[model samples]
Target: MRRLTLLVLLATAAPAHALDLTATVLANKTAYIPPQCYTRTEDAQGAVHNPCQTCHTLPRSPNFVSDPDLQQDYAIPGPALENPWTNLFVDRRAAVAATDAEEIRDWVRADNYLGADGRPVLAARLDRLPPEWDANGDGAWAGYRPDASFAFDDAGFDHGPDGRMTGWRAFAYVPLPGTFWPTNGSADDVLIRLPEAYRQTSDGSENLAVYKANLAITEALINRADVVIEPMDEGRLGVDLDRDGSLGTATRVVFAFAPLEGVTMHWAGRAGTLGPKVAPLAAGLYPLGTEFLHSVRYLDPRPEGVTMAPRMKELRYMKKTSWQSYAELEEGALAEKKEDADFPDRPKQFFGSAEAGIPNGMGWRLQGFIEDAAGDLRPQSFEETVFCMGCHGSIGTTDDSTFAFPRKISGPGAFRDGWYHWTQKGLAGTPDLVRADGQGDYAHYLRTNHAGDEFRSNTEVISAWLAQGDLTPEKAVALQADIAPLITPSPERAIALDAAYRMIVREQSFVKGRDATIAPQDETVWRRVEQDAPTGIAEPADPWFYRLKR
Candidate 1:
């Protein structure tokens, strides 16, 4: 009965073009894999290969909540042994060479996400119960509706027409240094919605002040640093906020090793400002009902400059459906490792229907909608979603199987401690992120990775940052002040890359590969690899945060 329901849902929800593609993908699921799973093990020397450190690394400070054993060995499971990403092997230079750059530019610039009525196209479509997306045989969409208006209040909450909060709050953060950087391929944004309990005061009343305070506290706990917040009345809350033995005016949430010791306030706070009471807030984990909505889009390259586009390439959703205690998370990781050891070569299988989502072994379940051949959103096949689990499920770099939220820009310098959207303010004039040891983040990435992206194929970045075949100290200093020059692609390269990806979409060959490439990537990628083999590195590399510490 469950299988029949799923078949009905897929038949009703997926478009004809997507149905064919999904069928093809499902028929030979094991034959397909993402190119990123194949790490570059060998360097130019062909010796001292060190690819394991990219995803598998020693857990670092502020991220010690994950499995520490992941750094000790390679734990790749099934479907990762072969390289089915044929897109990487394709020579797309001809397609790029024949493209009308101007026409492609105009098409990209035209917004596909919004209608002439100035409302979201996906939102309107979902509201109408379109057969192509109405799952469960229900007349209404049961899944997440497009509620983020991109219009946020001062506290970063999105409000609907009834003037009630839509519950989706958009926040800005430093983009993770590699492919996630806009110059690589896509422009993206992430919005978070906490469970209703977190949005209320101690007495269960919906007060915006209490909500903002709760968010600030969560930010402080996640980042493990003092968070600056707008001034609020602490006396009325009846919480002895500063540990100063009295209810006082509080300007920040103090992250302290000993809260009773009365730690010093952040430098951004005014003289005599006190810390908020944080004894009640849990550390490192979001509530079980939390949801994150992320949208990946194309780059809007205009004659003047490049910015984020309104047309989305993909929409991803993650929800925490269950709560795994700290002991449970550790036990789960060890159990999975034992299973991998027993059958290292066997591909691990995930259990779930495509209409719902696949569980990531942790508490979260992920689902994604991507563009079809016609550039409209459709559900991603099971195999495509498996690619997401590899990173979110067991990567050592993640804190609680997540990124972005922990790396959110904070302190007084950031605009509202980075709780806004890209549309509110793009990534220009944003200073380089400084690590705990005060090293520049972007500069360190370029120095270590030697390229803007993981593939090291971004010629635009290589030419700019590695003009002399190396990133010199002088160039590194310049990047520390402003990162725009290091991360933004030239208008010509942006248009060409966009054109290259559209070719893959038209071909409906996402099962084979989905990377946007102007040419074949033979130099950096492998066709196949032996499972559980040594990655050829003597010592595991540190996590991205720890590497920047020096």
Candidate 2:
């Protein structure tokens, strides 16, 4: 058939090459623009809208920027103005259409985390460091080891085969609204690990009860609200667990707006909690040394439904390597803006050692590992890691340069107060997050973006949520109760998307683009744009803070 010939031609269109595991980090020729921002739509009045303000706006707490005016523009460095993603231009419809859905489904469902011999596959790969990935020519990997066992205790702590805690704790939160949703080609999970001091009692003892209380306290501080916890002895903490003028048996960790007398928290001091100086520390500011491991995986679509594949497509790690005072954060942001104004065409340059990971300039160091041509995990090249710095380094939507943990579900309705993994409970009955304006989050996104994803390409979502090609009041109301129907793709779509991405993996063409598209995305993205120009919108959209405001 003609279809088979076209598929064969497309598959061989691009030549395959050996994996590039080099550990060289390269400077960006232009400031990067994420593909997500390309998802633009016109209002009913036919006015074009740019939603860049959603991720680029003034901070809510510790309003760090000295000049709010500078925050309005894209303000990328002059040198880094070129769009670096070349894969956007490549057409892949033939390859996607040619895929055998069932075959891709079976491949995705295959266990990738562990070998049939019962050992971690990624761990084994990492143990044998390839010469190409060793930037310094050292045979050892200097990065954090893949220690997550995927086996969790009741409290969500990852436990190894030796019955020892791996210090990684998995938590469930509503995925970020757009590209991060599972229907968009990947199923991912986030795990958090605090410093050893916070996981210890005032007496320096490793007591689980005290550790739980400390974690709850940190959570309360970040969220600025009372946090529920199982009953614990307050005497062991040696601080007023509940700020009611005295310490007693406590069931909740109460947050105090002001410092309380005789309630000095030694644990807070150890965790480097910088009590209100110029402004209150930004909401969701974690203590230094907190580490987060995130895994982006393939979607395993089945007769039943789609779930996360054990085989990871990408493993991302970030750590709060240093603490930035509120003043330091503001100064750095302002300086970047000034540079943008002075040199509108000069590309931004990043300076960091490749092996340690690139600094996001917000106290966090980010590193990542992605799949090779053979579908085995390999270290991302320097240019590959540079793709990550843009979002994490200076995004208005994030709290302390992070997204998921701050959005972790809370309140009595959440399972274990939102401390469990996705495997424990999928997003089946999770309700739509309510925005500050009291609008259902998903419904508002649909009404504004006019599509399920940023690309406006997900026809499946558009058809379901926007009956008659528009999101009516009835559809909005229906979404508030449960969002799984809107976010989860059909089994066929899932398999097709997975197969398309597998093609990119086989080609080792991540530098071009990483979007899992079944067709060429000419309409959704721009190859280049005018430097420092307005995004052709009348006004900026509201920031994520409005939705996160409790």
User: What is the alpha-carbon RMSD of candidate 1 to the true structure?
Assistant: 7.5
Per-model TM-score on C-alpha atoms: 0.84, 0.89
Q: What lDDT does the true structure give each of the candidates?
A: 0.66, 0.69
lDDT of 2 by residue, 23-114 (tens): 34344454245765443334445645444544566565543532223223434444444556666667767677777776677677766666
Model 2 poorest ten-residue lDDT run = 272-281
**lDDT of candidate model 2 versus the reference:** 0.69
Best candidate per TM-score, number? 2
lDDT of 1 at 492: 80
- Which stretches of candidate 1 lie above 4 Å from their native place? 1-34, 44-54, 60-79, 116-119, 127-140, 161-163, 202-204, 236-243, 256-281, 532-538, 547-550
User: Following a full C-alpha superposition, what root-mean-square deviation does model 2 have from the true structure?
Assistant: 3.9
